[model samples]
Target: MGHGWRTLRRKILTPNVSATYLETRGFRRKDRESQELLEKVGALFLAGYAHAVEASSIADVEARLGTIEHRFRGFAYEGAGMGYGMLDGLPFGHRHHNDDFLAGPAADQIYIVYCGIGWAMARLPRFRWPKAESLDPLLRWLVLDGYGFHQAYFHTRRYVHEHYQAPRFPWPDDESRAYANRAIDQGIGRALWFVGCTDVAEVARLVRTYPAARHGDLWAGVGLASTYACGASRDELVRLTELAGEHRPQLAQGSAFAAEARVKAGLWIPETDSATKILCGQDAETAARISVEMRPEHVRNGALPSYELWRQRIAEELMSLGGVSK
Candidate 1:
């Protein structure tokens, strides 16, 4: 059984460079039911992809993508397994083996993976949604080869990407097509809001505005409140968005709607990595903020660092070899 588990791990860890091979691999499930569920969702993804391909125009493809989005949203928000409602509601942010931390009923990890995929897929063809048929291969790739990758990615990559490279858009971008792609590549407008840089007064105001019991989606609010952290006036905020459109085309196109979504939700706004850097060097406030904001008590209390911790651990190791302490 140990050897079998090792084999399973190997298969999962193997690189998935080929789309064809990805189409045929079986899932690693502890039960018959999970295997069946996997198959069902895989079919749904494929059908949606095919529909997007068959659609007549960009609008039609978007409509089909909308159907896929709606279905995935149902899975994300309402499905019995691994939905956003279930994951976001956990108070402690701790995953229990008996409680479905990485797998099983509370598939928060998987649901997040799917949501990220859906978000990106619907915005292909250089961040433009692809024709329906072109999407099939991508969907198939996701279900077969991409599943484990996403599982690991959410646990680790999501934070860095969110902070360093990724931004969630509530809807489509408005910029000219050419500019949007480059901006995303250069890492514009992607920062997680709650990483401890917020002013205490602001935190207090927000907590008072939202009772602790309802702060489960607090990160969403962080994005909305960001410019305030920068002390940007309303006009400045609008100017920043315009600057993003003019200079960082990718960010302007893709993130405007997402920023608006956060704004509408009464959430705080995103503070870029540069803003974070301002808070990171030589001050107690910066250290405290990094410790508290990027990692809360639940995360800091763990025996093993989460995925992000491990990455940092490796960097620390290399730094030590170079006789530098970061």
Candidate 2:
């Protein structure tokens, strides 16, 4: 498309900037610092989305995304992933946009990119959803994590307060379909961190309102978001660890995943180090190493997808270390 048309497309496609504001979304405003940090994340995400839809090529998108600060840069790539995923879903656009992005500029940001596609999934019609066959078998579940986060973040009353769960997610077109809701719940768990504005007690209370069975996944999500997003203080993180109790293993597992993501993307910050230590009881490098070492070679083996198995292995490993309870 021409530059003019692309600019128009970007304007039309991107959500209003106000959508990122805490007041606009009715999300909690626990503290000024946390609120500002989360809002900046939203702004960076939108900036990345704009760049992706308007840029002429992947290189252009990469150049624009690189301008984002190191800590927030992954989020921009994530937004770019969403932009490319949206473009790929459009009737007139080539289907290879996400593929090209994953193979190129998004290589190190794969986890965030896959989650970004989930955001596109939330916006795109069900018929236009990216084909399950095209995604990584193990990590594709992260897309649902993205989707769940989108729904919970934007439709908090239903997905969060009401605890609504998608009955049977029809993506991926496989036997693993039944597990889709769990993956999405993990995403919702992540959103709760933002919705609570990084308030440890409030986030925990919200998770408690859900069914006991879902608490593990939800807490895991919280761990991922709190660690990856880095809005909470050392005290808040410790409080979260105390609140997690029996789910600490799952929480540690999620934290480890965030550690790996930040470390791999070269976005590791002081907050990452502190969060990993407090939540996972390991330094960022060791926590990240645990996540890497525990990854299953295959994407599928038993009733659960390899992703869940990978998660299980990580949790198990962490629990064995006595850092988190069994």
Best candidate, TM-score-wise?
2
Given candidate 1, what's the lDDT at residue 51?
33
Weakest lDDT window of 10 consecutive positions for candidate 1: 137-146
lDDT of 2: 0.91
Q: Candidate 2 clash total?
A: 0
lDDT of 1 at 275: 26
lDDT of candidate 2 over 79-172, digit per residue (tens): 9989988998899958899899889988989999999999999999999998887788888899999999999999999999999986777877
Q: Return the lDDT, model 1, position 169.
A: 29
Give residue 258's error in model 1 in angstroms.
Answer: 15
Candidate 1, residues 1-326, lDDT tens digits: the string is: 25455345334422232321112442123234433433444444333333322333335433543444332322222121222112222343322211232244223234223333433332233333322232222121222112222322222233222322223422222222222221222111121222222232333233234333322222212322242124333344343333222222222211222322223222322432222222221122232232233322333212222323422332233233332122
* Superposition TM-score, candidate 1 onto the true structure: 0.22
Q: RMSD of candidate 1 to the true fold?
A: 22.0
Alpha-carbon lDDT, every model: 0.28, 0.91
